[model samples]
Target: MKKITGIFLSMLFAVTLAACGAKAPAGEDVKEETKTEDVNDEKMTEEKKDDKTSAKTDLNVFAAASMTESLEELKAVFEEENPDLNLVFNFDSSGTLKTQIAEGADCDVFISAAKKQMDELDPNSDTKDSDITIDPDTRFDLLENEVTLAVKEDSRKDIRSFDDIKTDKVETIALGNADVPVGQYSESLLKNMGVWD
Candidate 1:
């Protein structure tokens, strides 16, 4: 998995370089825009004059809302490491990000919060829309997060576990939206515990 993650990061950097009209070098950074002029008899070729104009100024990345802090830190490091490229982030719910990509938004990378949202963007997905297609080779599980139960830091509530949510002592319980991945997991857990009807 570490090897795969390294490969994936390399691919992302390569893509960034390609987008900025630069070829990936061996452990070297692209510091400036390169312009190649085709001189025919000491005169610049018209077709090659404006090639640098096509160099992308930004690499757009769509990420889950939960990844905002981490991605922001990465963006800073990435931009500092690759001076020629800028990373632009679009953070939102995984489902929303998936929808945006399906709608033809310009995205160089996508980091989803859930497997269902990512799977829906996969080209081989049976549940995905026919018009939406993502190369299966480019997909990988990058992170895994555990579902946790939390309460206010200073609260006097006696809630300690899932079982406590059903007790009369606990007045209120907070949960994610039913349509989201977190909520789905919570629902499944409750049902398995025989607490969900």
Candidate 2:
């Protein structure tokens, strides 16, 4: 994932450099010399027009809230290198983001924490039937994550694994709501353990 991210950033940097290095047409200097006053006036007008055209464009990115810290860090470097782009981020659960997209929210990029949310949005996916259309060619797995169970250091609970949660040593458990991907994973895991009833 890091390698892919590095490559993507490199490509973007190269494109930015190429655009910055572009030169004006060859005859523009000669034309400017012919009518200096008129050319200067036209130049200012053109510059102003160019400014309007080159103004920063807002690029809306909807991503899972788990990615908030990392994406925020990347945003700084990305915006610094691509001054013409202004990234507007909406960080929330993948399910929430999916709902927002389905409801016609403007989203230029979407980074889902789970495949289920993305699949639901894809018209080609067998798992869903919807009018949403996304370019399949642009979709790629950026990362893989694992679900873990943790306990406080000073806790007296005898829990050591998923099975331990079923014993009387455990009283209460905290799990995500069904609307989020992590919650779904937790539900699946608990169900498979025969303790979710």
Candidate 3:
């Protein structure tokens, strides 16, 4: 975990530095760089330190409930790896998290299970309320998850594939809240398969 966290932090730091135009010296620039590089490096390092110090230490992460287990593990590893960085996570339905963030909750990161919730927070989104303002530049797709249909291991019912869901063989189907990402996906899938009508 620590090793993974370290690598992730390094990549994140490098990415940030690259974005700020702190690229590696190349060709003719290398010769003229060494002399000024030391001074610039020192100044940049100091500035970075100062910026980090001045920035909020606590990062509020709003994520879907489905991500709780994985995020908890990451939280433990991340906090242990970066002692100075504190992460506080709020795990719930993506819809609920989006609502919280839109309602003025201080969230540094939001991981929605569905795109609809994230769309609502986009500052440029036509559907976004006046109160909801998310920086478009900071929003990016981070991950994609596969939604699978499952049943209890010891279940007596022979409920198995997606097609079986439409048949009377399946007694009850459990799904997330309609407003949640998982639920929305499930509904869409079922509707397309002619099972949700």
Lowest summed-lDDT stretch of 10 residues in model 1?
1-10
Q: Model 3 Cα displacement at 86 (Å)?
A: 0.8
Among the numbered candidates, top lDDT falls to 2
Model 2 residue 178 CA deviation (Å) reads 0.6
Give a tens-digit lDDT track for model 2, residues 1-197: 00011011111111111112234479686665556657567767776656644566778888999999999999989988987677889999999998887776777788998999988777668875446545667789999867789877888876798889888988888898898988999999999999998
- TM of each candidate vs. truth: 0.67, 0.70, 0.66
lDDT of 3 by residue, 1-197 (tens): 00001111211232233223455556757756674677678778877876664442677788889889999988878977876677878998888888787776777788888778877777677776536566677788888967798898988878778988878878888997788777788888989998786
lDDT of 1 by residue, 77-109 (tens): 887777556677899877788888788776777
- Candidate 1 Cα outliers beyond 4 Å, as residue runs: 1-56
CA displacement after TM-score superposition, residue 61 of candidate 3 (Å): 1.2
- Strongest candidate by TM-score: 2
Reference-based lDDT, each prediction = 0.67, 0.75, 0.73
After TM-score superposition, the amount by which residue 10's alpha carbon in candidate 3 deviates from its true location, in angstroms, is: 25
RMSD of each: 13.4, 11.7, 14.9
Off by over 4 Å in 2: 1-54
